[model samples]
Target: MPQQELFNNIYQTHYDKVHRLCKGYFNGHEGMAADATQEIFLKVWQHLDGFRGEAKLSTWLYRIAVNTCLLQLRKPATTKEIKTEQLPDVVAEEYNPVTDERLKKMYGCIQQLDETGKMIILMVLEGVEYSAIAEVVGSTEETLRVRIHRIKKQLSTCVQL
Candidate 1:
């Protein structure tokens, strides 16, 4: 496929997943999610020629996403939280519980996790397979599994507090 066509197809295939991950990183701030998603795709476009197929395309996109979202979070100006109430119907599950008190606590717990832990948990939450996640995090599957177990234990403790 031509690069533009390839990008469109890739965007269609992965936009929701990428957006969901970005939103998770941003604590469900939809605007930031949208902005980060755009920035991610823009970077992908700029660097499309560099993809050498050493990994699955999704894995590459996710690696870029992890880095991009982390960069967005690191920007001091981006700390201004502009929360709006317009949750996209497509991502309705993302804004669960009608009342958001519990959800906020969970996001807070997630945000407090170290970067790799945060990526692992968020990708797991998005239903990414364990092997794929391990690839993205550059860990053995067995090690990722152990970290997942520990992360879950930590999250449960954090959430219940």
Candidate 2:
């Protein structure tokens, strides 16, 4: 199959999952997630020819998504204030996750986790197989399981508040 066709198939199959993973990293900021998702695909398109078949395609795509989000998060904020009298559209959208206290606490707890824990839990929430997640995060399956159990324990105590 042609690269374009293959990429389309991959994007269609995985876009929502990748977007959700990015959103998780950002504690559900839609605009940031959308930006990271776009950056991830651009990288994928640029490097598509270089993808070796050693890992599952979804696993590889997820690795790119995670890295892109981390890079975006690490960059110093370049946003400037607009002197508009109106609130931002993101605020007006009214469907944000932060609207729910429980969920907001959950995202806060996730953000407080170590980088690997955040990546692991985000991928797990995306319903990526444990094996695939383990591969992307570079942990053995058994170690991943143990880490997940510990993360769940930690998050539960935090979120129950």
Candidate 3:
């Protein structure tokens, strides 16, 4: 396959997953998540030629996504004020206050976690296999299992409060 076609194929295949992963990192801020997702694909395009196929392509893409999100978070913000009025209004068919409140609390808890913990738990919530997450996180599956258990326990306690 030509390089452009290969890059296009990989982007189409993994974009949504990468976007959602970015969303998790951004505390559900869709705009920030989208920006991060675009930056991740740019990095993918730059580094695709170096891919050695030692790991699954999805895993490589995910590693890029995670690193991109981390880099974005670490950058200092230039704009202090958010112009929410410029954003398009989102209409929902049905609204449940209870569920919304619970989700808010859950995200709040997630935001409080350490960076790596947040990444690990988000991947776990997304149902990424332990082996894959371990690979992406540079840890053994057994260690990830234990860490995930602790993260879940911490989140449960936080949400219940």
Encode model 1's per-residue lDDT on 3-59: one tens digit a residue: 999999999999999999998999888778999999999999999999999998889
TM-scores, in order shown?
Answer: 0.87, 0.88, 0.91
- Candidate 3 or 2, higher TM-score: 3
The CA-based lDDT of model 3 is what?
0.87
- Point out the higher-scoring one by lDDT: 2 or 3: 2
Q: Model 1 segments beyond 4 Å from truth?
A: 78-99
Better of 1 and 2 by lDDT: 1
Ranking by lDDT: 1, 2, 3
lDDT of 1 at 77: 88
In model 1, the clashing pairs are: none
Model 3: residue 22 alpha-carbon error in angstroms? 0.9
Looking at candidate 1, what is the lDDT of residue 89? 35
The prediction achieving the highest TM-score against the true structure is: 3
Q: Per-residue alpha-carbon lDDT of model 2 for 15-84, expressed as tens digits?
A: 9999989989988877788999999999999999999989988889999998999999999989964545
Quick one: RMSD of model 2? 3.4
RMSD of each: 3.1, 3.4, 2.1
Tell me the whole-model lDDT of each prediction, alpha carbons only: 0.91, 0.88, 0.87
